[model samples]
Target: MQPLQNAGYDRAITVFSPDGRLFQVEYAREAVKRGTTSLGVKSDEGIVLVVDKRTSSKLVETKSIEKIFQIDDHIGAATSGLVADARSLIERARIESQVYKITYNEPIRVDNLAKKICDMKQLYTQNGGVRPFGSALIIGGIFEGESKLFETDPSGALIEYKATAIGSGRSDAMDVFEDKYEEGMSLDAAIDLALDAVYEATEGKTSAESVEIAVIEKDTEKYRKLSQEEVSSYIDQLVEKKSNDEEETESEE
Candidate 1:
């Protein structure tokens, strides 16, 4: 017999409360916030996509937990939130890329493909009985000699960023970016910055086995995931630099 607080607006995806907010869409965003940290950084040389897998058990095979995906030869995406929901969007992105190729005889542009996915996500919010996708994506690529990075929300909003993060540790990751991100850093430098951000976000809990990285270089325009050996090398470099910086700070203090 209790009275409704939201006036029943929270019960349906299609309903909006008096405050002009969609409760279901907000809940979907909450799901993304609860997921592990994922981020993207764009530099003059290319783009880097990074994700923390946050493996909770030793027995779980790290390779089987995929958070980064290739949408086309040039475009890649890093996702946070419900993995299954992200898989559906990834599939749609791949199909969109192929369809554009068949129709226009060229690969899809990074922003265009992201818009297409956001359109699909928007459709779910307007229709009754369908819930918003509980996920967010960081899509990056090289298009026509230019680098692009985009972030998509469950409410179907899309934004372009020089460097950005999604999920639980976004604030920590973004603080690092704000301090260190440069507009035209080399691809190697961008990768270093990305590692630094993820390190802060995960509170230094990251290792090669618990992280995934992919990159699209302007020279190659190919989406490539780093191998375990490559990831390990980067992790080692990050650890060494962090140790050195701490030593310097302590000596100064």
Candidate 2:
């Protein structure tokens, strides 16, 4: 009998198909691609993380859907893909940070924490019986007085970025960043750019309640989430600017 199409290559996480591809890992990446949009921007002043909660119903509490997490005083993460899997990975990250601090009497470096998480992710891909985590993380923080941003995928690959986005709206968000991102931007400018990216990613469907924002300031080294009111003000500003720009185009015509 002829073998089945794909020859069951994707049946196990440990299996690798010809041309050096792991189908299971790629499938996990697809889970991330289908998740809600999340992005991170790094500037000299700090790092900004923005996520679209995309609450579907009014009955659901906006606060209950958390796509951002604080792993340490200086470290924060934004996630896309399976939220449960993201939470599990976050819990492990928190533990790793604490353990490192207790053992070394100093907070773990941002890169080190990212590597630990990626190591665990890599392990699952090489082992059988367990599936890879269907999530990707955009981790940002202050390390040695410097701001850093890192992105990790389900396949254990890690990349550092000045600004990056993941999930279903990644392309839209990235298009904005590629055009506008600049180095040495102030924290306020970073926040504005991040909000703009989120707005583009969501196709202007975002509201203060359906979005979350966080920042890790380089000087303070503290992670903080912007209050709903602050988020609202920013959203209003962006909306008004967009409206005004449209009006100008109409006048030119």
Candidate 3:
């Protein structure tokens, strides 16, 4: 995909497909620039989205960059692939939220924003067969004074989930989550569950590195991204224990 040099275009740009049909393309470079897969978990405290900042051209060699983004004060979005598409969608979501607030005189809730995203996804898919690459969105915030989480797909379908995981290692992560997650858990417990999920997802795989986390709270309009130090401390004990187990296994072998 070619990057458009000029900025400030109000409408979606059209590109011709091999089948001689026209497709609408929005911001296209944001997804390719970043490396990471996005994950989200929601609880009574609010929603948390986690991303591992590792990108690999091949499955073997991984590099790190920031992949999680704060689309608004209350909502956070992350991407796995096609950084440009993710960013563009994020920007669109933000604008949509703003427009909603102005038009309706009320803050745009997570559900509303999610529908807007789904609409955009439908627009992109209908124009052509080409879909956005690895662009899954985890939308979390307080909607109508209650904490909520929603996951949106490339085609704009949205699901309200208690916890959601995406990206390459998501299946493994979900296994861990299903084994440990409980509704109405405390924030600290939720954080621990999230870390364990990441750990399990990356197990026996070298592609996972650097996790970023964020949280939202009920009655609060903003979602807060946790510090690296804070996140590391929670998982440090587990990592040490895993290291010790590995050492023991090696000695036995």
Query: Largest lDDT belongs to which candidate?
Result: 1
Instruction: Answer with 1 or 2, whichever has the higher lDDT.
Output: 1
TM-score, model 3 to reference = 0.74
Judged by lDDT relative to the true structure, which candidate is superior, 1 or 3? 1
Model 1 lDDT on a 0 to 1 scale: 0.94
Highest TM-score: which candidate?
1
Give the Cα error of residue 171 in candidate 2, in Å.
0.7
22: Cα error in model 3, Å: 16
Model 2 global lDDT (CA atoms, 0 to 1)? 0.92
lDDT (C-alpha) at residue 225 in model 3: 78
lDDT of 1 by residue, 21-115 (tens): 88889899999999999999999999999999988799998889999999999999999999999999999999999999999999899999999
Comparison by TM-score, 1 against 2, better one: 1
User: What would the per-residue lDDT of candidate 3 be over residues 149-169, giving only the tens digit for each residue?
Assistant: 787766456798777677666
Put down candidate 2 lDDT per residue, 5-117, tens digits, no spaces: 55678885558777577888989999999999999999888999999999668899888999999999999999999999999999999999999999999999999999999
Question: After TM-score superposition, what is the CA distance of residue 89 in candidate 3 from its true location, in Å?
Answer: 0.5
Please, what is the whole-model Cα lDDT of each candidate in the order they appear?
A: 0.94, 0.92, 0.68
Off by over 4 Å in 3: 1-35, 55-64, 128-134, 204-209, 241-253
TM-score of each: 0.97, 0.96, 0.74
Model 1, TM vs. native: 0.97
RMSD of 3: 7.9
